[model samples]
Target chain A: MKKRITEPVKKPAVWIGFGVLFTLVTPWYFPAGSWSPLFWGIPYWALIIIAVSLALSIFITWVVLCQWDTGADETEDER
Target chain B: MNMELAFGGWSGILVLGLYGGLMLAVGLFAFLRHRGVRESLDEYYLGGRGLGAMVLFFTFFATQYSGNTVVGYPPTAYRLGYQYLVSVPFFIMIIMVYLFFAPRLYSLGRRFSLLTPVDWIDLRFRSKRVSVLAAILMLYGLGNYLLEQFVAIGQGVSGLTGGTIPYQVGVIFFIVIMVAYSWLGGMRSVAYTDTIQGLALLFGVFTLLIGSLIYLGGLPSAAATMAANAPQKLGAPTGTALTTWFCLLVLVGIGAAIYPHAFQRIFSARSERTLKRSFIRMAYMPFLTAGVVFMVGIIGISAFPDLTTAQSEQLVGMLANALANQNAFFYWAMVLLFGGVIAAIVSTADSVLLTFSSIISHDLYGRYVAPDASEYRKILVGKLVGVAAVVVLVLIAWYPPGTLYQIFVLKFEVLIQTAPALILGLYWRRLNTQAVFVGMLAGTILAAAFTFAGYRPLGVFSGLWGLSLNLLLCVGGSLLFGASPAQRERAEEIIAFPPSAAAARAV
Candidate 1:
């Protein structure tokens, strides 16, 4: 008989890393002058930030779908 | 203060009445269906752990967004300019924070049949002092949060009705409806009504945005106006403003994720898949909701320039009022928007009130005050006490102090103190109970002291200062006191679950 082995997912780092990159690190890389260029009324820099935020959202969906497992036939234990 | 309605008079009154009646019908339906199963705390507080993806998703939406997103966020954006773009990303950070602990916490909830966050604390630490202190902290945070909703209800009604309805009347009217529904069906009524209210708010907001663009001109025009009038508002943020933005992202992300109401929603999920699906949907909500509202606020900078801070608080209502006077279609939409604002506030209040009573019933009364009490007796006491709490909060709302932002800070400052213990305890086995207690106490005292003293060191929020100390103590005290080998083993067992389960299989 062969035994089946499953490895735990390590995608939480992707979420944390992307979250930091979009919110904290990326904003500093843009120069103050870069905000002057407008795309459809939104500043270019602001549009970039919104795009990063959208990516973060999509990343979260992927992590939740691929990474979490609730456990099997769990009986309720009284605390 | 003088009140002005967006589409005041009979239309606002009619819409409010219809919305109220619909909520009542939903509550009655839930009550009748749940009558047989209402004896247990799980059924009443957690909806028998049977919420599907849609109901769970909407309830989480309503609780997290609230009336603040509609009424309060605009003024901050008006003041901060493009800097307020931080709001959208900060909301996304909240879902990410949940990823750190929600999976393990959900599994723990199933394993121990947990009812409240305090229950998990009591189970993990096995310390009466720790549990009682945590419950008190949660109660204080929740009470303040509920108080904010009451104030928002009164403001939204008076502002939207053009003074046709007095602030006091507005507060009383919605409070009665919210408490009635929650009392009748508990979590079931709250979650179902949340779905309705959430849809109304989403529709109302998008319509308002479209109307604003069409009437006041589009974003390109608005940006042009700002460039000519207030170029600073469109420029990139640097210096202290940029630093504050970073603090907000971290603080609000962690603080909101560990909110007691939000924590309970994790347990309310029917299955691990349901919980995950709901969260996955929730991740994208910031773009639709907060992102849109942020654009509206920025557009206001061009639409109504030179307004003072106090006047800017009325940005949404003023814009709605202008649009209502444009055409019949916008007239009805503005009415719906204002009514939805009030409903959003009520929906948030009901969720907070439900979680508040659950804490009192399950953690305080059932666990400490009357250990042998039946579920019925405990729930009865919780309901009565909850009503009494509403009465006290209503009185405070009648005489609101400071601005909405100040009251907002007060709640988050206190609530975030729980994060170090709640989030860290999930992964770290050697966290000493005494360390947690000391850290919480020091954090609470420091947060309150800093806030009262009007101290903002380097423009960073007072909550972050308290959290810094809290995390320091939790980490330092645990190292100094240390857990026993047996305690470490017990923690390992509590946090572990079979990877084959639907929730852990992915992890």
Candidate 2:
């Protein structure tokens, strides 16, 4: 039986999209209230930022694992 | 927030001694094992470019995060409040920037057997002036970086010892051990020790967090305290603060991504698979390292309110002291935390020192001063000069000119100037060599000028101002004196390697 091979497509947009959403867009929306609804001891807006930052990291790991291929000419060595 | 009350007595000395002894042992072991390869720069500088996934991951981790993540970052978090949450994302942005150039650079490294970042500049442009300028820029940045680590080591040691040991003694003790190890094993010892140090840092940081939360009441209590006092810190950033946040994201992201040591790690991966796996792991590190430390900082704001700016810098020590007073277990944990912070700083300093030596030995001396010199001689020259540099840096660290934050920005501003030549040079075939040199020179001057002038134009960082000028010159100059037909064709051919080939080079 023959195996199938698929090329990994570079999806920089995935990283860029997340980068923009988290860094550019999210900062604008942080709650203006200094004392606000708290989520698990964090202010609501701060919690949201942390949550999105978490997502960004996860997304980056996924992209790194799936999107990059350094080509076939290079060979692994134990030196 | 009394730093001098953080640690004292025999326990601190015992821990510091154990950590130092362990580092020395690792260095000696690496030296004995890899002595055969000592004559060659490749073995000394890059550990023969054969690092596996775990070692590569941890070494990169230890080098990038550094002591600052533990000691310096918390204060920023305490001062800026939620505004400092930008630290977490900015680290993530570094990995993104890596995605832009590292893949190709890795492939090129294997094809040409590139040993240093400046080696890549030499390969691409084949211009002596361009390579030397980039080398000087990297060396300056590494010097500043090493100085920061030296200063941190002194502060961490003295603070942990409750001023039992003088700051000068603390700095000298670690510098001696660090330089000894680096001189012995080069990259091998550095990477091996980095694995141990990185784990120590992780364990210590998490333990500190648990101890903090357990003793100082959990996040909810801290949040309530913060809400009652220092409300501005909790409020969202507005106007200039927001702009500065964006600028930090870009400047730190690009500046850190292109660090000479970081670039060399790309060249040192055992395989493309190893490189990719390592990066995947690094992506999550911000949360575990920077993100966790940021929370620790936020907790300090409520736990010890009303600290002046200088006192705020002692947030870690203050918290550790309070925790140590609670129980035996907390005391031991705080000891480990301080020990780990010192180890982390040493690990970072060793990496920088290795890169610093390599640039002087290979790029400046071997390439220019004495091209006919043997490999062993070049290695010797690099080592001697490295020791000398450490001596000078120690003096500066002993009598630091400015605050830690100022020294921190000094390195990044100059280092980021090299980004255009390196990052754009990877893909843009027509990037003129002369243009790269001019841009780097102009950018570096403007950056230094703006910084000294204390001109941060409209709340923007001085580095960004210089970078803007640098980018303009690079793009404009490239057009003005366009690449010759031969240069264009050569660049196209060099860059046209299939991505898979680049990946497979290490397979």
Candidate 3:
């Protein structure tokens, strides 16, 4: 059985998605010092950044599970 | 920050002693379980490459979130306010950066039985100059890093015991214990202790947050306090602060993911599946550790308003004190929290020391000085040298080097210079070895000079500035001159090995 080999570096979509998420995680796109309309006692912008960070984590999980396959472990099993 | 907990005294000393004893016991356990730990570099340094998912995850956790994360990050959050929320995502960014290289790095590590990051460098470049230069740079950075942990451990110990155990005594006590365990079982001891330290750190931070919320106030109250007086703390970062936020994310993301100790843990995993699972678990840990501590700092704002910058350094200690005074349970818990803080520092120091010795045993002495020496001899030399380094670093930490302190601060800057060679060499076949040597040298020189001069153009860090130049030279020189055909084919044979071979192995 030929393992479905994948590397995260080879996937353009993965990079593009990460690029977007990384941008969102930085809070540079938010209005400077404009943290009004707080929710759950968190500044609105802080909340947004936290949510994006969560999304980044979830995206990382997806990439690790789906996009990382090198058959190294299957080879180890063979050994 | 010089800090002392209110509940620090005999109980603190007692807990510290117990934690040290527990670590030694763990080391003994690892030694008894694996009698051949000292017989091979692979068994000693990489735990024979058989670490399960949970141990790998905890070791990674221990690397990222250390005693500093518990005792250091809260004060930072207290000062920076919502702007410091960047700490949460910055840690997550580490995992994000890992995704770009670790998948392939893990496979290569397994294929080649790579023991240290320098091993990978030597394997790829096959140039003594490049490999030795990388090795020296790693050793220097790791030495400074261990020095830092030693200082933290001393301060943590003294502060927790309220000077019952003097700073020098506390540092020496832990150093002896740390070296003993690390000598006994090698990476196995370090990883097992890290699991324990990681748990203790988590427990410490969560209890502090819970105690603060229960006794002091919540985010809503803290927000109101910020609104009334320090609205800037409640606002999103702008201008220079925004630049700092962005710089931290990038520097920490790449620098930390490639930390020599953290990078080496990749080769220790039992299998690629275990490594992947550990990383997936690590991706979300910042929320539980960094995120919780960050909240505790914000809550401190409401509890102790109008604290000066110097006074704010004692914020966590003060908060723990207030909680301890309220109830007996919190009093004991606070003592354990301080003890945990000290243990966490030792854990981080142990990992750095382990990696430091491995580079000595595997890369420097074993490979060059005595290629025919027994594994036992190599391990012995590495241990003795590592202990000598500790003694020197302890002296430096105690009687401070009065000048040229910026040279010691070259830890991250110097380590990151190796990133281009380590990460790029994995993929780019045409990467010139001469260019790698020149780039790493120039990058370290530029970073150290800029840092010594306190020069960060455009609010960007000196390390990133050095990295930018290093990347330019690495890429430009490769595209212009490229590697020799033989080197290119070697790279291909190592990295681009055929999938058909892998498929055959799977069968």
Models sorted by DockQ, best on top? 3, 2, 1
Predicted complex 1: CAPRI docking category:
acceptable
Deviation in Å, model 2, residue B386 alpha carbon: 0.6
lDDT of 1 by residue, B350-381 (tens): 99999999999999999999989999888988
Q: DockQ of candidates 1 onward, in order?
A: 0.47, 0.50, 0.83
Better by TM-score, candidate 3 or 1: 3
Ranking by TM-score: 3, 1, 2
Q: Put down candidate 2 lDDT per residue, B359-476, tens digits, no spaces.
A: 9989999999999998889999999998899898888766656654454448888999999988889878789888889999999999988887789888888888889999999999
Worst 10 residues of 1 chain B by lDDT: B497-506
Better of 1 and 2 by DockQ: 2
The CAPRI-style docking tier of model 3 reads high
Error of 2 at B30 (Å): 0.8
1 or 3: which has the higher DockQ? 3
Per-residue C-alpha lDDT of model 3 across residues B26-63, encoded as one tens digit per residue: 99999999999999999999999999999999999888
TM-score of chain A of 1: 0.61
Which ranges of candidate 2 are over 4 A from the true structure?
A: A1-19, A22-26, A31-35, A72-79, B400-409, B499-507
Q: Pairing residues by index, what is the TM-score of model 1?
A: 0.94
TM-score of each: 0.94, 0.93, 0.98
